[model samples]
Target: MSTEQTSPAPTLAEDDVDLIETTSDASLERTQRRSDAIEREIGEDPTRFRILTGDRPTGNLHLGHYFGSLLNRVRLQDAGVETWVLVADYQVITDRDGVGPIRERVLSLVADYLAVGIDPQRSTIFTHSAVPALNQLMLPFLSVVTDSELRRNPTVKSELEATGDRAMSGLMLTYPVHQAADILFCKANLVPVGKDQLPHLEQARVIARRFDERYGRAGDGSRPVFPRPEALLSNAPNVLGTDGQKMSKSRGNAIELGMDADTTAKLLKRAVTDADRHITYDPVLRPEVSNLVLLTALASGRRPEDVAAEIGDGGAATLKKAAIEAVNDMLAPVRARRAELAADEGYLLDVLRRGNEHANAVAEATLSEVRQAMHMVY
Candidate 1:
């Protein structure tokens, strides 16, 4: 989901507004763009690298997932570079409390990934719960990172104060450390993430670098063992919930995958729009209407501004009709593909097992190096 949607709404609670932290211009634009020369090089030789990224299976994915990361996942996988989709199942317990739904949610999430065109054969998709050794790496990895670093992470801070309770549970604070295990376990050379996730990735980089510096230097004084992995950033698409809030399951504002057309239409009917009752492209003035335009543009492969212009003076009603048509049209094919795949749970299981095996081979090799370096080898 886009950070824009998942962020705390403008109306803040007393606990949420604690101290009102801010960002400087330099940090604001960090990783917003990469050096053009490096981008060109990656495009010219994309297959020379591997990508690692994933989601915590807290809830079913939503429209925010589609425009932000799901679409990117499909595009990246189609590009022929090695990609891995991880289900951070344990991370689910960090902030959310709905353990009852987890088993169903994880299975549903597996279905959603398949439904959304994450080719199991092309991209490695596995659950964290199934991997014991990878989780074992977390205890050692935790030793290298300091507490201040954990407390200062912007994402962690945002997550902590998002609700009134201020959830800084050990699991929540140590999330980045767990995330480091997720990426480093795969021996991944690149992590595709949004700007908000850069801090978490920074922690991973720190751990990888620290481990190598302290342990990877051989008796002969060779270079560090870890890859010194780099972040391969992609522009995450902006999306909002029907209420013009950030799309999130917690806020009850998300449009989900696997929704039938009837349900989608009902939700879109209640979607927020401009007060002037006119459909226009001025996102600067009309975020609600513009969000609808964005939804259509993403679904139909047209520019959002162009979609607004096409609706002209007909107002939001016209735009809604057009948007619904475009969205349902897109959903029809995805639903059809998903139905076909749903007939075989056995196939999905095999795919995940194979992916785990491939992932485990790489992770085990890296962990072996780590153990040997730290003199922990059996």
Candidate 2:
């Protein structure tokens, strides 16, 4: 296990300072307005949009994954928008030493997706390694970005901090560029992201714009080879772990989607909470208890305050029971479906095989266009 060290914040250059200012309250308000308009437009004409979003197959997805992203992916696919979900397998090695049972984890991830109503038929689910042409775009994408830009990316900086004393790998340093390739390879115009991830999307947009200006036939009749993708900011509440911190698989605090009801109940029993016998929703004052209330609200489709009021004077035991019941009830169907899918490994492989074939076809076409634009088709 890597020990996390607290290092002093790095000094920001002038350009980095400007980049940080973009996330200020006023800028976030503007982003929210744009997101609202996009939501309305999506409802009006879903076919005009294409969304690319996904997860790295590091482990079984937990509640954080469900509420934060998977639910929204299902909604978009069901809304008639073209959706592509990438299993970022190669990215697993960016921070870690080796891929531990990557094949098993990938299949398990597919099971989780299927369990949660991600219709593979409606959405394309493919792995990063399966699409060679997609990775090939990395060369051009990397060329458009500067070393300072890559290092200045907030996501990269945080990821580096998380790795402790391990030297940042070249792969890790260029993670953002590879992500740009993932988005551009499919010509995806919309990407779902949280506030912290906005910088990564911006980097992708920069690469797209720079590549278009440097190599694209702008003055002529042809359109740019890649679209500058915009962020579709998520409105999901940040769900904390049982330990009163952000839920994460590595932290061992996450309640995985694959856990059975009994297992879930057992985990909730061990969850931390306040000594107060009365329950109330005060995230600032009573974060641990409030986190449980929040989870219950998300699971039951009720408000957090309402749940807390109902559980008033019920104490920690009652609070844990409510969370366990609500969460298990919500996840019952997902767990059932996951079990059935896990039993059929052949079916899972077939899903990946078909998705890979489709991804390859799309990536090859995009690469051909890129080669022609750069005058490297020969």
Candidate 3:
């Protein structure tokens, strides 16, 4: 299911005409070198880094989440890097109206994390709204960046475009700054993000640098307040949905992490595949079939070409069955654990409570330092 693909050109504002250029091969080489170095560094001394990565409680997480970033989070946590997973509850409304069953969603998200081996004991799982100090950092953070910088942010621009026709909120525009607060609050030095999110990380770096330049001096010695976090770019595969489009809960093409075996099989039955009797892993020629093959490979920890060759002449039915079996088998334990955790709502809430308390303590310390650095401690 592998194919040669070019990175999508970032959707930039009209003013960012120069920034719209495609990624050069040399730039990619440098990124790859940096990624390799980071991996080695993490291996040598995992304690030297703290990672902050999270999701908005938009809906139930799906396989796209599992393979994309969740697994990486688990790996980093297991490797002993200090991990902080924030449930971006407040950011959910940055674009949408009304919080819809937010409490349930947040709890469910925690359950998902726990089910997938994100040890609550090791990783702090907190919510955005509960950490007031973290959000408060956004005030000073915003002061460092300008309106044009926010508007030019690629992630914000893409989100705005997604909201199509809806008037952008002030919160939505300052989303990147809020993200910076999320990272810097805990002083997380590493952030797991995809290439598309590089711009947002860059904005966070800019804010950190500007804030330090403006307010990071107390005496003759310079004391930088915030660390400019680097992006630990993900190497996860681009997993498409059942319909051959991007896997999304909104599109109803996602296989949710909470779905039982029967439900997952039923959904896979509807997966779009070509009428060709022969099965082959030609992503460029047969994207839909190749997507299914990739899913099965990812699920079973096998290679896509091997999965494709195994079902060479069996056609779509065999492919779908293999995918169903592989996915269901992999998720069986996760589903079981999720259901068990879901039954104990109090436990989930307690996890959030503890995480929030810890996050607040850390944020308050950071904010206090920020104030002291800016000579606002009086």
TM-score of each model, in listed order: 0.87, 0.93, 0.92
Backbone clashes, candidate 3: 0
Q: In model 1, where is the ten-residue run with the lowest total lDDT? A: 1-10
Which candidate number maximizes lDDT? 2
TM-score of 2: 0.93
Cα lDDT over the full model 3? 0.87
Cα lDDT of model 3 by residue, 1-378, tens digit: 222222232233522432332144565566667877999999999999999999999999999999999999999999999999999999999888888999889999999999999998899999999999999998888776778768777768787788799889999999988999999899899999888877777777777766776566334436678887887889999889999999999999999999989999999999999989899998999999999999999999999999999999999999999999999999999999999999999999899999999999998998888877766765
Relative to the true structure, how large is the alpha-carbon lDDT of every model?
Answer: 0.74, 0.89, 0.87
Candidate 3 off by > 4 Å? 1-26, 162-165, 218-221
Which of the predicted structures, 2 or 3, would earn the higher lDDT when compared with the native?
2
Which candidate, 1 or 2, has the higher lDDT? 2
Off by over 4 Å in 1: 1-38, 162-167, 217-221
**Model 1 compared with the native: what TM-score?**
0.87
Ranking by TM-score: 2, 3, 1
